[model samples]
Target: MSALHFDEATHTYTENGVRVPSVTQILAPLNDLSFIKPDVLQFKRDLGTAVHKATELYDLGELDESTVSPLVQPYLDGWIRLRAELPFEILGMEERVFHPAHRYAGTYDRLVLLDGKRCIFDLKTGAMFPSYGPQTAAYKNAVEKASGKRVEGRYAIELRDDCTYRLHEMTDPEDWQVFLGCLALHRFKNKHAA
Candidate 1:
């Protein structure tokens, strides 16, 4: 097994003691969230993060529902609703994976058997933006590379604030290429950092 470490504080990954950029980091150059005010952006980031943690804990059977904060309850409910509808068997949750060839790493939300199909997933607590496709594509690619098992599907489950979710099938063939392009640009920019 390769030594892959994810530092939660910095949202970074290190493989074999060498720093490796994450999917989001590589795609940051093209992610224009600038329209959101800084404070609103921070709040959204925090809420999304909290929801992810709560959902992971719940999936692992470690969450105390009673302790769930009211602020994140709706998002959790959205996830639960999705579970009720899809009825998936969880194979992996909050899994950290790295692509040896691309040298990028990311933590995917879940890998599941949905209707007997192997599907990799990403959970979102906000709008299902166009970027989600590439984000999930990068995750699917990394997970497939780290594990020999083939991932037959890629999805983004957007959990809204009102206890509802929309499932998006990321079937676009160009999404992975988009992420790879971002990675290349990131590398070039890093190499020429002033």
Candidate 2:
């Protein structure tokens, strides 16, 4: 595993050789006027792409195996198999939101009742870590707030050849708030930076 660290406690992030920016530094006024950013739009686009790809795979079956994503093939295959064997339906994927309280709209990967329980499964194609908890929670909060429905839990389908998954049951609201706050703070900084 890689030890890439983004000091959220300090509000710093380091990617490759670029110096990380602090939340305060980022939130600092760039000019007299404030503006919504293009990056946010791009982020929504990227999320849309991811959600679209997952849905395509789910609807059309697995893509032709490629040499690059071989390690994650089983994970996708397993999800395909699970999706096929059961009466599981893709309730909605990449549904957009226009909530006023939300910093930005969110896209949900899957909203389906599994074995009689409503669940949210996020497709993870990258590395694993505990840091993603808040982001997921924020998504849950956003979805629930937008849809006026309660989300019981959050999960990640780790797509690999081994086809393993990690299930995270949503805890109380406090921890969920922490993650949401972090995202909110980041958005504040991002807006200022723009």
Candidate 3:
């Protein structure tokens, strides 16, 4: 069996001595964020990191309510509200997984049982995008292989700034194909890079 290690500082994974690209990295070709300013983008990215940490703490029952940042409180509220609306049993949170066959790695937000079916529920603080379809699908494939559980569904939940959420179920199997295509393209580019 190949060894896998996740470095928290870089949010990266190395499998059997090889550094692997993540799902987000593979999907980089789809990103068109040139419209957003650099400083604004940095702030959004920082907010996302903080919010994800808060939610992970909450899931692990380690969150100190009093210490929650005011800037991050709204997202936590939205996440909490989402739990109330659609109750789920969490199987894993912020789990780093690697797919040896594909030579890639990623961290999934939540592996859960929602509506009596095992599913991959990704949490996002930003607007729901089409790319999320394949993003969650990739997470599903890697998670199922690592955990030996058949993911029955793929969903992405957007936790809004107004404490509301939009839950989207990704039902297209082609999303997996899309992710594979992205992965292939990513590998090709990397291999031929100067």
Candidate 4:
């Protein structure tokens, strides 16, 4: 296992002198077109980042609930509720892992032990989409490859605006294969574009 560094200027990950595609970058081209303005998407992305940061702090036992900003409070409350419902022991959070074999890298949300089951927990502050399966599966594969730990299940935890959350278990057997296809397409496009 190797450390992966993200260069903000280039918006890409590099490990061992090799540039690798992030999981989101690999899946970006497949994102559905939105009639909604680009600003809305940007807003959601920003909000998602805030919520994820708050959740990470909370999970690490460092979050001061009263200090959470008003704009992200609802999402924080939703995460609090979901946290109560989850009985898993958190093993990892917001940790970067890279697949040396596939040459891809990503930061997985969480790795947990639930009822003696090792699972990958991906937190999403958006609507559930089919892409999440491949996205989380790719994270799972990377983590398992890097840590030598078998992940028995993969779940998408969606934080909603109403202080609630929906848990979706990704059960697709071919999701990892699909993600590999996306990675290949991403490399092909970048190579040809250059």
Candidate 5:
């Protein structure tokens, strides 16, 4: 257990020997609609904590009721069971390096291999939104680049609200190109800052 260290000056996360740029750090210059709502921030923290705890328990082979909120417990349990019983590997648990123009670093939620097919997943502790499609597409691009192979599908595990999971195949290469363009721009900007 560690405290969340915040840089009052930069508002970034600095803990566990990792520097996590605040949401504002990545979104501030991109657009005006980058404000982090209170609810969204809370959900993000909770989701990350839940995943971390689940991972620890998995390593120890411990199976018990999840510590996450009841509404999201089902999804957590399902993931644990699936991981234990199914033949799949979660690859994105390892931190990946990203060199972008404006953004030099970022991490994906989860990249997995299931049934000999690559899968990219972004777990959400909230309701599904229309924008999730593009977000998942971005994850697909990130996973593909990091793994040097194409992903068969992108998915979002909505743990709360509707508690639904959605999967979509990446049929359009153009979408991936757009995502890469964004990463390039982010990397460029970061280099200029450096």
Candidate 6:
């Protein structure tokens, strides 16, 4: 499959001239009215990005702990501690996947073999929410479609700021259907918005 391109200006993913919604875009409208400030949202996004980068580097054995920024160091440390306990083989990292059947695209964090099971590992650096299940489910479907392999498990691993972590196993078929509903809503919203 060709690499999917996201047009920042249009806020859409285009693959082979077909515009497809991203996982985030599909879930954007479903966010609860917590009234989080814009700067706070941006900060969280930045922190998550940094932590993901650090995790990727660590997985590839190219991480330089000294160069990791101070703000994300704690999260990185937590991930490191957690990674030590899990003996899994990394199949792919930061892999871009497209679902032709659903016409959506997303970048999954990692595909791994954990305990002889093919699973998707999604990393989070913030509070755990029910929406995360649907998000991970969507990634699982897309990744499975792209790889022609069945994903037997899905998980969300959260790296807390206190140098601790939580591993949540998310294997709910209902969540995948929920994501499909969100995709339909997203298409309707975007189609009318244009």
Ranking by lDDT: 1, 3, 4, 6, 5, 2
Model 4 misplacement above 4 A? 8-10
Per residue, candidate 2 scores C-alpha lDDT tens digits across 1-194 of 11223543643444343334432232233212224377865654454345347545656556555532443455556666656665665555644332334433344577777766666776664454454455456567667876788877777655444554445555555646665566567666667995
**Number of clashes in every candidate structure?**
0, 3, 0, 0, 13, 0
The alpha-carbon lDDT assigned to residue 88 of candidate 1 equals: 89
Report the CA-based lDDT of candidate 4 relative to the real structure.
Answer: 0.88
Better of 1 and 4 by lDDT: 1
Winner on TM-score (1 vs 5): 1
lDDT of 4 by residue, 1-194 (tens): 47679886777899977888899989876678476589998998889989999999998889998888888888888889977987788999988889899998888889999889999999888877798999999999888888788999999998888888888999999999899999999889988995
Poorest lDDT segment (10 consecutive residues) of candidate 2 = 24-33
TM of each candidate vs. truth: 0.96, 0.57, 0.96, 0.94, 0.55, 0.92
Error of 5 at 11 (Å): 8.4
lDDT of each: 0.89, 0.53, 0.89, 0.88, 0.54, 0.87
Q: List the residue pairs that clash in candidate 6.
A: none
RMSD of each: 1.1, 12.8, 1.1, 1.5, 6.7, 1.8
Q: After superposition, how far is residue 115 of candidate 5 from its true place, in Å?
A: 2.7
Q: Tell me the TM-score of model 3.
A: 0.96
Per-residue CA lDDT of candidate 3, range 1-194, in tens? 86888887987778987889989989988788888899998998899999999999998889998999898999999999888888889988888888878989888899999889999988888867789999999999998888788999999888888877888999987999999999999989999999
Clashes of 3: 0
Error of 6 at 34 (Å): 5.1
Give a tens-digit lDDT track for model 5, residues 1-194.
33335554654555455664433244334333347687977876677567646654654567465445665566565566545665677766524434222223334466788788877666655444444455556556545555578878776655433433334344555655555555556557877995
Look at candidate 2 and tell me the lDDT of residue 5: 39
Candidate number with the higher lDDT (3 or 4): 3
Residue 39 of model 3 has an lDDT of 100
How many pairs of residues collide in model 2? Answer: 3
